[model samples]
Target: MYIPELYKNENAEEIKSFIKTNSFGILVNQTQGKLWGTHIPLELETNLQGKEVLFGHISKENPQGESFTDNNEVLSIFNGPHSYISSSWYDHENVPTWNYIAVHVYGKIRIIEGEELLFAMKKLVDKYEATSKNPVKIENLSAETMRQINGITAFEIEITDIQAVHKLSQNRDDKNHNTIISELEERKDNNSQAIADAMKKQRS
Candidate 1:
């Protein structure tokens, strides 16, 4: 995450909120001298010891899971909305660029099993199901369904560092910034609209 000073977001609360909203992230680690990445939903949490950590799991069959040994460090990347900005949006001639938000978390990975795995899984399920019309609880699952856990490996990553980037054209002047937002909103796509909204919020 090479964030320029102008784009770097140092606000802890905003970064935490971004991670929670964009919990589905890419977990990267080295396996057999080669890098492997897994896409998964990671829950940001505070362990009993009061240390910040991430909880997630992957299928036992996933080769990436092997990298969790020896408390190896890992990188988790969370991405938010992004869109291309046309140079024409700016009043003065300038090169086109992009606007987006992203976060990178570095941590030490440790495999978790037994009750800890089950508890982590329960929390993950409960969080996602909260918005469902007919919510399902992990405890309500049948023994056979619960047996599926045997095929997966759960782990926790104790966070050591977090880097957040919010590249929302902060370098531009007020007129150009507002124009960029207007153009993005007119694009009518989710990413464009999201970037526009974020720009508006940043200004407010």
Candidate 2:
């Protein structure tokens, strides 16, 4: 994550909050000299030792799941809304660019199983199901259905480093930034509107 000083987001709490909101992220690592990646839902948590950790699960069939080992380094990427920024929106001449928010978390991986895996699965279900009108309880599953949980692999990552960036027209003047936001909001695409909202929140 090559981030310019103007766009870098160094606030630890803010970064953690972003990850919590956008828990579905890409987990990447190298296996047999080849790069492997998996799209998984993850959460930022504190371990019993009071250290920040990441928890997630992968399909048993995914080779990346088997590749993880104790202390193996991995990268988790969380992406936020983004859209094209036209140079015409700027008060001064500028090149077209993409504005977005992203966070890169580097950590050491540790595979988890049995009761620990069940605990992690429960946490994931509770987090997403909280917004449902009628949340489904994981414990409600029958014994046979619960046995299917073994088909997934659970893992934890102890966060070692974090890098985040919010490229929301920070290089432009107030007027130009406002122009970009207005243009984005006027567009029909939800992604554009999302970027507009992010820019507004940052400025506010």
lDDT of 2 by residue, 1-204 (tens): 899999999888899999998989999999767888888888887654566789998878887876787328999999988899999887777689999999999999998877767777787888888999999778887899988878888888988899999998877778888999999988979889989998988888
For candidate 2, what is the TM-score?
A: 0.93
Index of the highest-TM-score prediction: 1
What are the C-alpha RMSDs, in order, of all predicted structures? Answer: 1.1, 1.7
Clashing pairs in 2: none
- Model 2: runs farther than 4 Å from truth? 48-50
- Which residue pairs come into collision in candidate 1? none
TM-score of each: 0.96, 0.93
* Segments of candidate 1 deviating more than 4 angstroms: none
